[model samples]
Target: MKNYFLEISFLLFLLTFSSLKAQTYARNGMVVSDNKLASDAGVQILKRGGNAIDATVATAFALAVTHPAAGNIGGGGFLVYLPENGQATTIDFREKAPLASSPTMFLDENGKLVPGSNHDSIKAIGVPGTVAGMFLAHKKYGKLPWSDLLSPAIQLAKTGFPLTWALYNEGNYHYTNNSTEFLKNYFIKDDGSMTSFGEVWKQPELAKTLEWIAKKGQDGFYKGKIASQIDAFMKANGGLITTQDLAKYQAVERAPIHGTFNGYDIYSMPPPSSGGVTMTAMLNFIEQANAEEIPFNSTAYTHLMIEAMRRGYADRAEYLGDPDFNLEMPLNLLTSKDHAIARFKNFDKNKASVSDSTSFGHPYDGENTTHFSVVDREGNAVSVTYTLEQSYGSGLGDPELGFIFNNEMGDFNAVPGETKSNGQIGTDPNLIAPEKRMLSSMNPTIVAKDGQPVLVMGSPGGRTIINTVFQAVLNTILYDMPVDESIEAMKIHHQWLPDVTYYERNKMSPDTVRALEAMGHEMIPVGQLGRLMGIQFFPKDGVYFGASDSSSPDGAAVGY
Candidate 1:
């Protein structure tokens, strides 16, 4: 009887393993973001037999309607796609420098640096490319009809969406001190208070624009009435974007950055994004450290991760730039085993490394951006990262189209400096050269095993994008946690500046914090960390599970 019981137990173990593997099916899909309706809209597309590319286009269109404060048709972004048989590809649709923009545009008459260029329409706006990128992705791999994918966004824009607490709060925070008449009339309530949560906000003009695009295809915006309006508005407002810029824009398809972690293939956006190199460097350094042996979330693990972040960020500040303009970076800096071994040689358990020691190189400018991940029924996956440069973009919107413009010009270094040996300058590589794309920190990534996608994830946090993605992957892979729990876990970030480590309040253990403090580290409690979205597949059973950040008001993972 004892022997029989043992045999039964062994059978049960095999069944459990089989169940886990069987859960990975083509039909499983997930969408996550700061808006619930948008996330649901993407999942709906997935449920309707759309592949990951279709779902991404759908979600992106919906976000342009529902989350106008952060996403829009006026911005630009990067798209990373992984097909079943080939290497991943990255689409660079990042906003470009406007024709009127010059290297000295932000400099004062006295040659002094000027602050707040991010808020100026003349200095803020870039040639928008969001629409072009979406259309391009759809053209290449989307299975659903483009018009069908656009219908959901059109409905949301025409009928309006109720404001969530998060949206209401953020709007109030950003618009409180605005003195512009245009913003006051559009975003503020009648009684001098910001619009409250639950209020229905309708964007009729945007609805019409989306509808036009649905009917006319890509030409709807680039060459039709919308383009004319955008050109006229920029001309009137002293901005540089013209109808020609819109008509000339095209999304470039480039090779995706490839790396490996514990036999899983990792793919992400390459330059002009710092995400690929920085994330790989951190992960490579950690791999050399044998970080898995440290207790998960323990002070030692946290400390080492932060140290790695510091080194990676320092490298980012010195060596990263637009590859189109700069000489090819030593890609080996992040992929070489010898380089990883050398980086880990400086690891010290009890003291913080000086910035100068890690800051041996000079990278280019970093800018604001956001990311989203999607997986659909056909086993295809896409990770897209989009941005308007900064919040409210250039703080200028084409009055007629109801869209904000991108302030991508601030991504250029305004200071005059000599070019480095690698042909990178602190200033010009990402500067206001005609049609040059700005450098970004948006990193969207996918993890595949045995040539099939196993995980999809990305985040929105400007310079912290790499750190957020790296930690989440560690949680899911090294720590062996569920997708939801892994994303929900508290996160810490170190940007190699101000010489302090930032932590999310009340999420990390007090013991961990105490241990780091004792190790001569300065720690500050940050209220919230960057928002992350992810989905994991159980290959054996063909089931997909999704997870989103809990701190976000509207993020969700819905699976049938």
Candidate 2:
């Protein structure tokens, strides 16, 4: 009887412990996302003792499989890393212009802006850099072998994964207007109904490509059979990308743009991407506002931030561009404390500032993008942001290769006007040039405390990237909120274009909206705010916490 009772007690204890563990947060780490599997992959890597960069590489590959509509292997981006040694680095692997590109490519015979075709094979391409960038990051900081890190994505792609409601909606929205053969094969049913959530989606070709990459590293894509295949596809489809473009593609490692925000060292990507400079300038301006004392979401706080956004965006439009080409751009505009303070003097508390009135000549064009953040047990951090320029990326995909190309050429401004005070001509330095990279707005940032990394943050939304990062940093460091709440809170964006204040509905306070309206501001309800991802470290416990954007269907943070 005694033996039987002990056995029963042991069984009961085991059951109770299992239940408690299930109810509790994942202590090995947490990965929150719209797509649970993608998050799970990251958590798995962390559990296996891979560093943050390795986990990030795994998560990115998983995203490419499960969240194909947004996450992609054919795209390029920026990666910001803050190692435990206190060295911050940024890898600028953004897409590059094709060798055939020209500054006037987007202009018509009459010198007017041409209407861009969303499906022109010739215009749908850029030199992709994601593979190179990921490989470089892994080589530098990854704990796991490249093959092991890629296994999850390969399995998911080959065996298939279930689609979420968000993927269904986005796929339907993107493919609804025109049913191309490619769309029919991948996304649509015979009756033209979009594939619904819970349906299994597979990409055998992507799986094969991933397998090749795993075996051969970046060489498999850039100079091997994959490059040959891409060259053939582009040539046959009237695209300008050539094998030379692929063979010559390189991911440049650059020094991170650094700034001090309330004593925390902020690091982000530099030129060819305006995110770093613009973000630094905005934060510098806000630092002077003494924002810590203001109530969270108060009218005063919102007004000050909105005004500062206006100033920062104005600078982004007039003074920022591809540094290799734009030699006249006032680099001092962001680094000089005096210039940042001088710009702040123009902010008016009671009125919206007109962008053109405040800044010098020539407005520039922009593009859309995506961002993700990762942190590991060893304190290595990575914030990566990439894009295809626009939704569906010119709506052209190579069926054989199973990937769409980026339409980054449209990012350049078509019309050039008078020179600005910063010394640039009516021509945008970002104007398309042969083999020149288009200017991007992707900002991947890492924040350090006392020379050690404490936060890794970034966002995706064209001109809004800077503003989103600015707000999230303030929310996390100054407002003192957890990562999840800081990202979930309502957000506002003012890009100094059309001079309108765009706010996410039901996110910001009602009083804040009213205050902006009273200040002669035009308010528009935006369906969604920018997506942000961040990780915060707790020095006392030596544990790191991460959060993805609540607005994203697949934003997740996984730690171990």
Clashes within 3 Å, all models in order: 19, 7
TM-score of each: 0.88, 0.88
Which 10 successive residues of model 2 have the least lDDT summed?
A: 19-28
lDDT of 2 at 124: 47
**Stretches of candidate 1 above 4 Å error?**
1-27, 171-179, 187-196, 357-369, 418-429
260 in model 2: Cα distance from truth in Å? 0.8
Pairs of colliding residues, candidate 2: 29-559, 31-557, 32-556, 32-557, 34-553, 34-554, 417-426
- Give the RMSD in angstroms, all C-alphas superposed, for model 2: 7.2
